[model samples]
Target: MGSIDSYIFRTTLTSFAVVMASLTGVIWITQALRGIDLMTSQGQTILTFLGLTGLAVPVLILVIAPIALMIAVAHTLNRLATDSEIIVMNAAGLSPLRLFRPFVYATLVVSAIVILIGAYIAPDGLRRIARWDSEITADVLANVLQPGRFAQLEQNLTIRVRERQPGGLLVGVFIDDRRDPNDRVSIIADHGTVLKNSEGSFLVLEDGHLERFQAGQQEPALVAFSRYAFDMSKFSRARDVAYGIREHYLWELMWPDPNDPLLKQLPTQFRSEMHDRLLAPIYPFFFAAVTFAFLGLARTTRQSRNFSMIGAVLCAFVVRLAGFALSVIANQTPYVAGLQYLLLVIAIAVSVWLIRRNVVIEPPARLVDALNALTASLSRLVRRPMPA
Candidate 1:
């Protein structure tokens, strides 16, 4: 009995590891490709990119782990049946219930992990990613102007023909400042540099022209300049936090500040979001049960045994789509109608039924007899001589 238990555990764990690693690799590669544009725009370093990717792994694992486990278990059981190991176990008085112990243990371990990630780790990682993005955006905006391009710095200022010298000094600067709602000012220079002057940072233009347009004047007044300075520090400190649902944790979602502009008008959306995040962890357990149960519809060794695997995948898609649709509907409605709770209850009931049905039942004898007869007919047909 000890040997059998050990063998089952080892085989199942091996399968689990293979499936997890492969799925994680595939998901990571896809995410990395999708994020390339954002990464480049942020001027992210290789180390930063790698760190973000690493942090994403835990979230992916939490989401995909159950599906991986289901696939691994189904594949392993199929192999066992094909090799006649299950038949041998049956002959040795190993009941189906006894054989399911390892899987149950595995499911418990996976469920705990899923709970941890969904509740804590994922939220923390999300916060960090948001902060990193804010920082990168600040950096990009600070140095947005470039050479041979008319860079529009906000709505009021336009810079044309900007260049930087070897000493890190910028030259050939042109600035059009229309920032004043009542008056418009435009400055151009043959040679100028951006400097951190006493009054914040300033662009000191040399040998330039200044044009001021008064509100009532049809013609703009033009003035020549020897040296003119404009403040260069247009980019302000980053106000990183947003009042969006994605930025908050579970508790924050439930008890969001009424003072927050985002939550000031609509509280129902926040409540629905909280429910959705809280319920995400339950999906893995549901998937595990569904996969195990559906796999038992046919003998594990049946060549058409992939039906359950396909069903499991479909189940995942349907659940995701349903959740999305529910969230949208919840946002539109004014009250919390217990729809999420109802789904949870239905999922639990279905999962329980699947597990119980799969664990205790055996494939029908009539089906087996039919399969045997079909196999015999196919065998003779293959061996028969071809018609000349």
Candidate 2:
């Protein structure tokens, strides 16, 4: 690459990084918000919450990396035109193909990153999330206690704690049990701790008083205790956890176990996931190609290029949407995977033709003049005011 191509390449790569990071962060926050309950109600620490939510970032990047590249391409090209840099290059005898070389390099780099993220990084994250969720669900001690909040296990059982200390002492513990309609029991303690043993987990209340209320007796019976223990096994018992096909490894998706019950069953969905990942890396290049095709040439026109930009955006949108549709169809028929590659080839071909022509895309001259006249008439009508 020459000096100009090198400069453009650096600029495009930087823009892509910035855009991809910004997009990933924005989307990740929205997705991660769903896990906020882990910290608020599930007794999970901040670190645990972050770790669980952070697992989704790689997948988010896989989905948005291509879109970021296209935006970066459009932005770099537009900035070049706005600063007349492209015009200067053209005057220096730089052909359209030569000028577009930088974007091609940047797109390839981004595509490689997409391949890594889609094939390995993202699936690994999904697997981690599955394992983490399973652990949290099985850790009964952490699952049942929420500091400074009243947790209602059911309509009759209510538990509240004023706060919890670092050493595992729960302060101001209150438990109201009304499961037996005839006899109600309420327990209040100055402190409590959760203990796990060979048998099961137990919530042990210390320095507490237990009160019993018998219905229709109109009098409450109260007794004090040094220590009281309640079984917590129901809250923390481990159960079977199921993972989605997305959590599976690439090889698992490719050569799924025949005896594995799921692979033997809904094979179509597994095939669809595999094809989508394999084809993701091919999209950034074509998306960049389509965007560059519209504004590949540097024209001296003072008119707005908004229409041309919109046209390019719509064209790319249509192509990508078609690819998504094909992926969906492939779930039913694996043979349709070929159509995705065919679409990419056709898009690249047409884009190459557009770049070769090196002409500015716009509406007909007559249409532009007519639109200008119409705008003038509308301006006059608004300025004239109602008849006096």
Best by TM-score: 2
Stretches of candidate 1 off by over 4 Å are 1-14, 38-42, 51-59, 140-143, 154-156, 160-231, 254-264, 296-303, 315-324, 333-388
Candidate 2, residue 107: Cα displacement in angstroms equals 0.9
Query: Model 1 over residues 1-388: C-alpha lDDT tens digits?
Result: 3777777667776888899999999989999887775445433457878876777787788667877777777776777777778768767866655666666666667677777776668777877877766765554223465566787877877777566554445567777778887798877788776576445666677898988998989999999989887765556345556635655766777777778777766677777767767776666556656665665333435445544566666876786567667778888784543676677568757756655554434436797689789999999999999999
Model 2 lDDT, full chain set: 0.86
In model 2, pairs of residues that clash are none
How does residue 40 of candidate 1 score in lDDT? 51
Candidate 2: residue 187 lDDT (0-100): 96
Q: Which digits, one per residue and each the tens of the lDDT, describe model 2 over residues 1-388?
A: 8888899999999999999999988998898899898876667788999999998898888879889998899899889999998889989999898888889999989998988887788889998888888889877556665777678877888888888777678899999999899999999999999898999888899999999999888889999999999777777777676668888777788888888777878898888888888888988988888888887688875857787788888998999999999998998998898899899899988898888888667878898899899999999999997978
Q: List the residue pairs that clash in candidate 1.
A: 201-232
